[model samples]
Target: MLIAMAGLPGTGKTAIAEAIGARLLRPVVSVDPIESAILRAGIDADQPTGLAAYLVAETLAEIVLGAGHGAIVDAVNAVDPAREQWVSLAARSGQTLKFIEVICSDVAVHRNRLEARQRNLPRLSEPTWHAVEQSLDEYAAWSGPSGAVERLTLDSVEPLDVLVERAVEFLGRPTSS
Candidate 1:
């Protein structure tokens, strides 16, 4: 199985992904670290690294699935193209694909979380609340592949453990739920 998490930054998508990965014992592939590595390796700051990062994550997921293991991807898949790429990857790899969109519907709380976050990855600044708002403004409506994709939209206003429990239930993993 390939579990793909989507939503803007500070929505708790990464935390959810990590929790799910730990619960399911699947490798979690995050695009942020890949993008940060690219920037650290002297990629021009102005260069578009999102696509490259996604590609790297896609390859990592493929490798994991090929090894007869499931993988989870943590990324801000706010657009159709990004979602489509994952659907394609799942189809080619013959794996069950699930998309879990993590969101904080409360605007004020979302902004506070975004502003208060510290950058854990070296040389990679966290996106500002304004940037997150812009992303929400541009976010595309997602519809999974007909009859083949499973999708879930989670409101991340709850506690982390509760959110992870919900994800485990959604994934039908017996370990946590």
Candidate 2:
């Protein structure tokens, strides 16, 4: 399964993705760290490093899937284009793609989490609460049940272990032969 983790910043997307990756023993391809490296490599922040990072992650994921291992993508798939890219990748790779959209439904909690968070990506500036608020306006609705695979929506307010368990259920835990 190729799990696409989607949500705005501070929405617990990465945390869940990392946990899922650890539980499933799959590679988690995260966009922020990739974009950070691009910036550190002197790519101007003015450039579309975010998009470039997504492309890079897609390629890395293709390799992971090709290696016969599941891959998890950690990204803020806020818009149709970004989300479509993952759909296309899954189709081309013939992998069953799933989306785990994490949301912090409480405005106050979301804002507080955003303000206190520090990802420590040196070349990548953390998003401001204002930016996340803007994203709330722009984050497009999920396209569907993912067309090829089901999409699971989780509220970040739940405990991390609970969220991971739900995600694992959605992914269908492996059974020993």
Candidate 3:
């Protein structure tokens, strides 16, 4: 199985992803760290670092799945292309694809959380509230029928343990494939 975690920044996406990864004992390929590594390697911030990180993550996931193990991808898949790429990858790798879109519906809490976050991704600055808003503006709705693609939409207002429990149960179910 390949779990794709998606949401705007400060939506508690990474926390849930990490927790689910720990609970499921699956390796997580986080795009932020990959982006940080790329920047540290002298890739200019002006370059398409986000895209490069996604491509790198794709390869990592491919390799992990090829080894007959499930993997988790923590990223803000705000567009259809990004989502489609995961769908295609799942098909090619013969892995069950699961998308968990984490959201913080409380605006005040979301802003506070985003501002207070201290995720130490070297060379990768945390996104400002404005950037998160821009991401929301561009975020494509995870709608339409992507045949056999299982999805779980989660609100981060719930307790972390509860969220992880739900995610684990979701993933434990048999694949639609």
Candidate 4:
């Protein structure tokens, strides 16, 4: 299984992805760390590093899936191209693709979280509430071809465990430990 989690910043996508990966004992391939490294190395993260980060993550996902291990990808796959890259990689690797989109329904809470978020990566800059708000406005909802991928839309207000259970059901995997 290859679980690709997508959403805007401060949407709790990474938190959910981390929980799912830990529960399933699968490696989580996060694009943020790669992008951060590139920025720290004096590379602009705007376009060049974005491409590099995705390529690196795609390559790693392919290797992990080829090894018969499930992998989870945590990324801000806001656009079709970014989402398609992961889906295509999973298809080529012969792994089942599970697309999950996390969203925060509470605007105030979401904004607070975004403002309070700590930067774990030294080179990565945290976006201000204004930037996050602008991003929310610019975010394009996923509307890809049906049957090309299996998707699960989740609310950040839900408990992490419940969300994980829902994902397990969507994947047709047993919920039993």
Candidate 5:
């Protein structure tokens, strides 16, 4: 299975993806880490570096799928292009695609989380609340019908384990012990 998680920063996308990846025993490909590596290489992540990071992530996902193992992608795939790329990749690889979107309905909690969170990745700066708010505003609402590529929208207020279990079940797969 190829699980792709998408949402704005501070929405618990990483947490959900990591938990699900652990449960599924799958490799997690987070865009933040790739972007950080690109920046550490002295590339500006605001431009070409960002594009390169996505390409690198896509390549890695392909390799992971080719290895006959499930993979989870953690990204703020706010637009159709980003989401479509993963969908297309999974389609060609004959891997089941699962699209999960994490959301925090409580604005105050989301803001707090965004402001307090830190990125441990090298040379990667955390986004400000303003930036996160901007992303939330700009996020394109997903309208695709759910089927093989299941869409799970989770509230961050819920327990992490519950969210993970729900994701596993939605994918029609058993939860990891």
Candidate 6:
């Protein structure tokens, strides 16, 4: 399974993706840390590091899927191009692709979470609330359901346990015998 998680900053995308990865015992590949690594490796932060990081993560996920392991990708895949990459990858890898979009329906709560978040990685700069609003404005609408990929929408208002359980069900994981 290739679980591609998408959402704007502060929408609990990372939290949900991490929880799902843990529950399924799958490796989680995130773009932010990859971008941070690029910067720390003497690359200028002004470069197109975000795209580079996404490609790096794509390669990593491809490797994981090729190795016969499920992989979860965590990112703000707000654009069609980025989303399309994962769809293509799953096709090439012969893995079932699940696109999960996490959202915080409550605007006030989302803003609070954005403002209160502390960056654990020093090299990765955090996005401001205003930036998140801009991203929300530019986020592309989904291209509708297709046979090639499964879509799941999640509202972060639910408890983490509930969210994780719902994700497991959405992914069609079989329970232990």
For 1-177, candidate 2 gives per-residue lDDT tens digits of 789989999988999999999998998999999999999999899999999999999999999998888999999988888888888888889887888889999888888988898888879999999888877899887655343346789999999999999999988955222
Poorest 10 consecutive residues by lDDT, candidate 2 = 141-150
Which residue runs of candidate 4 sit more than 4 Å off their true CA positions? Answer: 45-47, 173-177
Looking at model 1, the pairs that clash are none
For 1-177, candidate 5 gives per-residue lDDT tens digits of: 888898888989999888888877888998889999889888865677666777788899999999899889898888777888888888889987878988899999999998888778888888888898777677876755323356778898888889888888887764232
Q: Which 10 residues in a row give candidate 1 its minimum summed lDDT?
A: 142-151
- Model 3 scores a TM of 0.94
lDDT of 6 by residue, 47-152 (tens): 9999999999999999999999999999999988899999889889998888889999999999999899985765788999988998878998887432246778
lDDT of each: 0.85, 0.88, 0.89, 0.82, 0.83, 0.89
Clashing pairs in 5: none
The parts of candidate 6 lying over 4 Å away from their true place are: 144-148, 173-177
Q: Which candidate is the best by TM-score?
A: 3
**CA deviation > 4 Å runs, candidate 1:** 144-148, 173-177
Q: Per-residue alpha-carbon lDDT of model 3 for 1-177, expressed as tens digits?
A: 999998888999889998988877899999999999999999999999999999999999999999999999999988888888899899899877889989998899999999999988889989899988887779887765442478888998889999999999998998764
* After superposition, candidate 5 runs with Cα above 4 Å error: 143-148, 173-177
Task: Report, for all candidates in order, the number of backbone clashes.
Answer: 0, 0, 0, 0, 0, 0
In model 4, the number of clashes is: 0
The 10 consecutive residues of candidate 6 with the worst lDDT sum are 143-152
Better of 5 and 6 by TM-score: 6
lDDT of 4: 0.82
Query: On residues 8-78, what C-alpha lDDT tens digit does candidate 4 reach at each position?
Result: 78888888888888877989999988889889988865657877988899999889988989899988887
Give the CA lDDT, 0 to 100, for residue 24 in model 1: 82
Cα RMSD (Å) per model?
3.2, 3.0, 1.5, 3.3, 3.5, 3.2
Q: Looking at candidate 3, what is the lDDT of residue 19?
A: 91
Candidate 1 C-alpha lDDT tens digits along 1-177: 888999999998988899889888988999999999988898977888778889999999999989999999999988888888888898899877888989998988888988888757766778888788777788987665622467778998888898888888888842221
